[model samples]
Target: MSYAYPRSTGASSLPSYTSVPSSKTTSESWHDLPNVAKQWMVEGAAVFQTARSQDRHDIRRFASLIFRRTFTIPSALILLWLFTLWRGERTVFQESIDACAWENWEKWPQGATPHRVAFIADPQLVDPHTYPGRPWPLSTLTVDYTDQYLRRSFSSIQNALIPDSVLFLGDLFDGGREWATSTTTSPEERYQKYTDSFWKKEYGRFMKIFLDPWMDQNELPIDGRGRRLIASLPGNHDLGFGHGIQEPVRDRFQAYFGQSNRVDVIGNHTFVSLDTVSLSAMDQVDPQTGGTSSVVNEAYPDPIWKQTNDFLNKMTYHRGRAEMGELRMMQNRSEGIQFDYRIVEPADSAIYSNDQDEPVDLPTILLTHVPLFRKPATPCGPLRERYPPSSTTEELEEDEPNSLSISGGYQYQNVLTPKISTEVVTKSGPNVVQVYSGDDHDYCELIHREFNGSPREITVKSLSWAMGVRHPGFLMTSLWNPINPETGESLQQGSSPTIQNHLCILPDQLGIFIHYGCILGLSILVLLLRSSFHVFFASEPALSNQSPVLPLSERRGDSYKHQYQTSGTSSSTLAPNGLASRASITAFPRYPVTKASHDAYRNLDQDDLVTTTSKDKGGYRPARPRGFRQKSVLMGREFVHSVRVVALVVLTVYFFLIWRW
Candidate 1:
């Protein structure tokens, strides 16, 4: 009879072969035909019986190993994914900033400082009203998920880029206008009720996502130059456009986010943020008659348009006053006069100052929600999605209806009219550097040669992923304005601050999910292959007649006896490598089971296979029970593995939860 050892142990434990004189050779035994086939089936059944006897221990060992790896590997991959991809915003944002490094055009002034401004456009925080057909739970989940994404992205920006100020170019909330209408139609009740209910909740959400993490309490942090932490304007979606504009909506927006029409002096340059939405409403035609309104002229009917008009008039008066003051100062200095005087302009100057022969020194960076007028066929750079107009006819339609709109709608307009565009650019003057606008939800850069000496107007892309664009992005601008020594303010006439803009695009979230899917598929494949290997190789050992089934003491010479004797313990107590032995009898050598082997062992009696023996009893003996130390060591190893698995699981959960909450 041949001995078969467990495959888990090495093949060196296999004993030397001992041939039986009457038995057929291992290669020739299979020629017995029917008799050999029957014997082979019997031997196969016996081998299965032997495996079944130890099946409980083997199953437990293999199952524990698989379970530990099942949790361990995936958990490790999840952590790696978060470290590299989920938090990869920092790396990408830094790379974008590096790409737009400032050039050494001239030496910077001592007082001049580089001010980095981060521009966030059209976040449009989602709500249930934004997507009516979606399930309520899904909508809520999306809102929470988007909030988390914004929070993480903002955190990355602060930690990595750390801009001096942030500018939000409108559309802060998706349902800002919706809330106004849904609360109440009456202008009187809408403001109070909207503030008390829906608006309050959304405002809280917005603050938590955008400001709370960085700012102190509710106060807007001001920098050394008196610039606030953030500057924002209202969008068509925020306060509505044209006839859709509600008085309460406008008032609430002003109360919360500050004046829609205002100017900021940063880095000695004028940033004129205008309420173009309300201003454009002046051109709104009566849908029924297609003409202007003429009712209630005494109080200047349609207060929405009147309010915007008043802001424009105030701006004109201020510009004229500033010009006259500068002119007076220059004349006084030239004449060696110390007295101060104020010059009063005639009433007609107020009406015609904007239409002057020489444009004012506005040197403005105009900010508006709606883009200025451009021909319907104007190319908005190669980055624009709808580019390279396929046909010349499609490119040159005067009333294409694809342009922001030829007219106005409920809450939006396509673009400002050519007349209004000329007015704004003319007032801003020939020194207008760049005009930035949003509400297009896509990146569009065009030159409006109609006014301001063809200033470049860039419509920033929306920052939210749900806004139709596949890739979301933000703009980073660096402004450097040198200060004059005589006056603490910026130089009146000199080289302007270098303004450089860089667009930083975020990764596609859907693509991240695809990567996760690949990881999962790979893990499952690994487990399947591992299980298959264990089944075919580890579980079944090879059965060969070349090795004899005998106890070491019975078959081996004095050399084997000397080794066991010198070990200071019996074969049961002492191990080859100082580990306690479990069995007193020698372990059997294993070989592949086949017909030849079966035929050889078929004639042997069951007593030929000696599993255990004791000298005192002089007969078969069962294996000894594991010692206390052995059991404790096994338990310790298992405990360590279990703890490792639990730790990985907890780490994976913690990373995912922290991002959401």
Candidate 2:
């Protein structure tokens, strides 16, 4: 049966990326080799022509080059072999280690459905209260760059990309106490909630300022079928400061935007948007004493993290259980498709069309604002790093895995959760192919590098350049399937979905010219140095007995006869007097006196020049074989040069490959 994809919008004219053709490393073909490489071969051919001359010295010069090449070719081959190996630190995101079949994309079937999703991180929306003469210094906190550039870029992305879904890896609010009045601006007032009028104003302001694309101007859902799917998870900011998750903030967030943690099922796939703050809000172990603690007794604990563990556990089991009917029901509940204002019911006919067959297990892509992998303690975001208590206090807490930071310093580490998320990931088995996270507001893709296997972590750029950080862009992901040509159905059961992550550049406050300019300048310097060295060596004089050129390619046609015979049988042709006759010889020439060839011969001294037309005379004679002693002497010299060639080759390989290995 044929297939249909949801809301596949085609462009009028796709942007052309074909300028100055070059391919990526993983995708390069043999055809991509440059035309300049062929020109180099021809240039080398024009330099060698004197081997066809009557001079036997030129023939020896050509032999010496051959001797050098024995070393040169082997050395180049060793360097080329070394270039194929990646000598960098081990990364689990390598295609060799990834658990999914995405590396084998070519083997998959064609015409599969492509699902596009855009990931944004840490808008950190700062909407200060406009109360008249507020006691607090809210007006002093002026960050104009975040206000101007970030909001404009998000609007640009929404209009330009028009993705199927937008996962806001949240830290959406700067200080999320909009409802609190001016009178109660103290630290204690952080937990206090205002009247209903305050919440209405807060929601309205947020929609207009930050999230206009997801809804209409009238504060209603847009009925453009398969329109923008909005999913957001709480960052530490969404809760109050010092891991403060107030009841009012949590309740209002759910009332407006569905849930803090949500599962979205689009077609056959499932995407989980998790509240990382809720999961990691409570520290299970005490820093002072090496013992387990409850949320109430813990130094930093709350109701958010306590319920988050239980909520995630139930949800994990609800989806993973093998029973088909209940599993389908769980997926349908999270289905993002809509007929009108509300989500389609579980009994909807359209939902059952493709899912008519017994429900089979599929991949689950997980997203968390706080990464499972702990990041470096170096500060990059707007959240300034003060002295953290656990980091400074030299306490009796026991050492843990590599995930938890045990360093006694000023920087604090985000400790491990109750292992609920890990358990869910482990129980999901092969279905969990990839995990993405954000809170750091810096781009980092890490892998667990487990003995069995692990998925990749793709952390994205923040929307704002708050702390003058480097990266500021959202991730665009394309999820597609391998469609079987014969059956026309996607090969989703055994295969993994193809995910392509693209980092779309937003405006950077600091330009990239300096970074790229240095690289370009270095490349030019290297090229100039190489060319200068080549010319320097080529202009130098040849060795005392060597020829200026060698006719390396035309060796078979040309013949050389030495004027003085060294062989025993050729002694009759030698001068009777024992004075060595001037080494006069006839040559069967390969290089005639053409303009190009004449210039090469013009460099020779008058004594070295040939007066007679050797080609017209046709007086070519082969020299007789030398005596055993003479032959042995020639063999000894050849053997010595060969040994030198082998020595150079060994040295070259040792320097290039052995050191790296």
List the global CA lDDT of all models: 0.59, 0.47
- Each prediction's number of clashing residue pairs: 12, 5
Candidate 1 lDDT tens digits, 393-463: 55443323223334456678868878678767776544788888888887777677666456788888787
- Whole-model alpha-carbon lDDT for candidate 1: 0.59
- Using TM-score as the measure, which candidate wins? 1
Q: What are the per-residue Cα lDDT tens digits for candidate 2 across 398-431?
A: 2222122423211122323436446446644445
Model 2 spans with C-alpha error above 4 angstroms: 1-112, 127-145, 177-202, 214-225, 241-243, 285-302, 316-359, 374-421, 427-430, 482-497, 510-661
Q: Which parts of model 1 have CA positions greater than 4 angstroms off?
A: 1-112, 181-196, 213-224, 230-232, 287-290, 293-300, 319-362, 385-409, 483-498, 528-539, 542-657
Q: lDDT at 621 for candidate 2? A: 26
The lowest-lDDT stretch of 10 consecutive residues in candidate 1 is 558-567
